[model samples]
Target: MIRLFKVKEKQREIAENANGRAPVKKQSAGELRLHKDISELNLPKTTTIAFPNGKDDLMNFEVTIRPDEGYYRGGMFVFTFQVSPVYPHEAPKVKCKTKVYHPNIDLEGSVCLNILREDWKPVLNINTIVYGLHHLFTEPNYEDPLNHEAAAVLRDNPKMFESNVRRAMSGGYVGQTHFTRCTC
Candidate 1:
């Protein structure tokens, strides 16, 4: 049965070559789903998506979020998403490309989001993840944190946390760590 399908595929390729047209590459199921999700995306005005590798390579892309409200307001954060070929079934690997001073994001750019971890389900789409990231900016959770120091400050002294965030966003030193300017 598999041989039969291969023969047919070869014939189709021959026909295309004879017609002076390149054979079309078959898209994986994950790619098809990603394309659909991207097409139906309803991104917020403060967020934008880019294909740094070009539109043809949809598996890898960048999402930039410029929160207009909350502690992260006016700060630009960039995240990189790498969707596996098994997509939907396996959550996309997301990494924060911009260093942010938040409880949920560590200095090394590791994001601590429930949806990106154990809470992730196949039913969740790219839109859900984007919104989840945006929510993190608007409401940084101190309860479940990746940066314990930031979380402690946010939990113990909200004012100090705000000050640290401002300093980090302005390309100043927060504690012993120096953060590059991310304010837009």
Candidate 2:
């Protein structure tokens, strides 16, 4: 059986060489699924997906969100996504690339989203995650938060929270934290 398999592999190698092209690498299940998700993506007009590592590296990508409404409206936020090879079984690691004052996003770009955490299920795809992220900008959740201070302001004084978000998005200071202008 081993000999037969080796012979077949050698034949395939020879055939590939004859074709004068590099042998194509087989796509893993995760890669295949990611490709499907990307192809079928129903992204919002305000959101855009980018492959900074080029189109070849599908496992890593970036998502840019520009909310059309809410306090974050007109502010541009970028998030990085690193999908594992065993995707569906494991949620993608997502991090905000833009520094902004938001209850669900921390200073270090760590996001506090249920779907990305304990609520993550194999059924959820990249499109679902993108919608969830868009939801965060439209309605910044104050209940479960990574930035406790921001959450507190949102919970206790929503007007103040709005001011803070504006300050952060306009390249101003929110407390001691300096934020770059992300508003467009």
Candidate 3:
């Protein structure tokens, strides 16, 4: 019975090739869901998504955010997203490609968003994550910080924090650490 099924499958492939049509490639459930998410995406004006590996490879992509307000105003930040095969069942792995001097983002590019970690739920979609990242720039949370120094500055002295953000964004040094220019 198994051999009969294999022969039938081979015949189908041959028939497809004969008709100048390629055999259909089966997609995983995660891919299907990701496609749906991408198709339904309604990104903010300051946010843009790009597929570095091309549109055919939607599993990995990048999102760039240019905040028009807040301390990060006129600065451009890029983040990379790597979606797992399990998709909604597991949250996508996100890392900042741009080094930013913000409380919620570490020097190593790890983001400190609740939804990306403990608060993540299967019900959440890519849009939610994108908005969350955008909100981080507009309202950086000092309480839940990935960079303690930046957080302390933000909490202890708002003015100094703003200064540090400006310096870092302009490719200057914030203490011993230097950041590249991300201003747009």
Candidate 4:
């Protein structure tokens, strides 16, 4: 019975096609909300978003964050965001693509940002997530750290912590762990 409506809709589409126009694809409720959220995004100067799949495909994209001040200053950090079709109700999946030595960011490129996890609320948007990520580098918390060794150093020895950070950022080893060339 619904196929009858589809046939009629198809006829309408065919008629519309005569005007040199293709039938408009219907967007899902999630797509509509995501569009609204994106349009309202007010990103900071240090952050920018890019769609590697192009503008037409907004569901998968990357964000770059360059901290202006902190131990990670001068570093270019990239993150990938995958928004599900059931967005707004479900938070986007976010992961860091840039590898860095940090208490909050894991080796496998998983980030420990609170907004992406337990702290997330439907009211939160992309802008809020970006800001929260930026805060991670500027003020790394030792209390709830993913890298316990780094956190312990930060908590126990402040001066040694600073020195190790400089060493690691310069593409050297803090102890036995060798870091790659860090531009930060």
User: Would you list the C-alpha lDDT of every candidate in the order shown?
Assistant: 0.95, 0.95, 0.95, 0.83
Over 111-177, each residue of candidate 2 has an lDDT whose tens digit, in order, gives 9889999999999999999999999999888889899999999999999999999999999999999
- Displacement of residue 33 (Cα, Å) in model 3 is 0.7
User: Which should have the higher TM-score, number 2 or number 3?
Assistant: 3
- Candidate 4's C-alpha runs over 4 A off are 1-12, 182-184
The digit string of per-residue lDDT tens for model 4 on 1-184 reads 9999999999988898898976677888878877887888888888898989987778889998888888778778899999988887788898888766788877677888888888888888888888888899899888988888888988998778777777777788877888766563
Measured against the true structure, the TM-scores of the candidates, in listed sequence, are 0.92, 0.92, 0.93, 0.85
What TM-score quantifies how close candidate 4 is to the native fold? 0.85
Q: Candidate 1 vs candidate 3: which has greater TM-score? A: 3
TM-score of candidate 1 on Cα atoms, chains taken together: 0.92
Residue 108's lDDT within candidate 2 is 96
- Residue 125 accuracy (lDDT) in model 4: 83
Q: Candidate 1 on 77-148: residue-level lDDT in tens?
A: 999999999888888999999988999999888999898999998889999999999999999999999999
Error of 3 at 125 (Å): 0.4
RMSD of each: 3.2, 2.7, 2.2, 2.8
Which residue runs does candidate 1 get wrong by more than 4 Å?
Answer: 1-12
